[model samples]
Target: MQAIIFVRLFRLLLGRQGPLLLSLLLWTALGI
Candidate 1:
């Protein structure tokens, strides 16, 4: 499912820029 993939990506980016990536993801999701 998309949620699973999102979680995986979240974990991957967490070490680098988790908050930034999370905000971007949420922003994109809301934009669509």
Candidate 2:
């Protein structure tokens, strides 16, 4: 399902930026 694709994307992001980028994205979304 498309949900799995999102999980993969998150894992890829974790590999690249470790966890800060994830929090940054979440914060930006919450702010908007």
RMSD of each: 1.9, 2.5
Question: What tens-digit string does per-residue lDDT give for candidate 1 at 1-32?
Answer: 99999799788878776888788888998996
Off by over 4 Å in 2: 16-32
Cα TM-score per model:
0.56, 0.43
> Using alpha carbons, what is the TM-score of model 2?
0.43
**Model 1 CA RMSD to the hidden true structure, in angstroms:** 1.9
Candidate whose TM-score is highest: 1
Best model per lDDT:
1
CA deviation > 4 Å runs, candidate 1 = none
Cα shift from native, residue 9, model 1 (Å): 2.4
Instruction: Write candidate 2's Cα lDDT for 1-32 as tens digits.
Output: 98789778888878977679778778976996
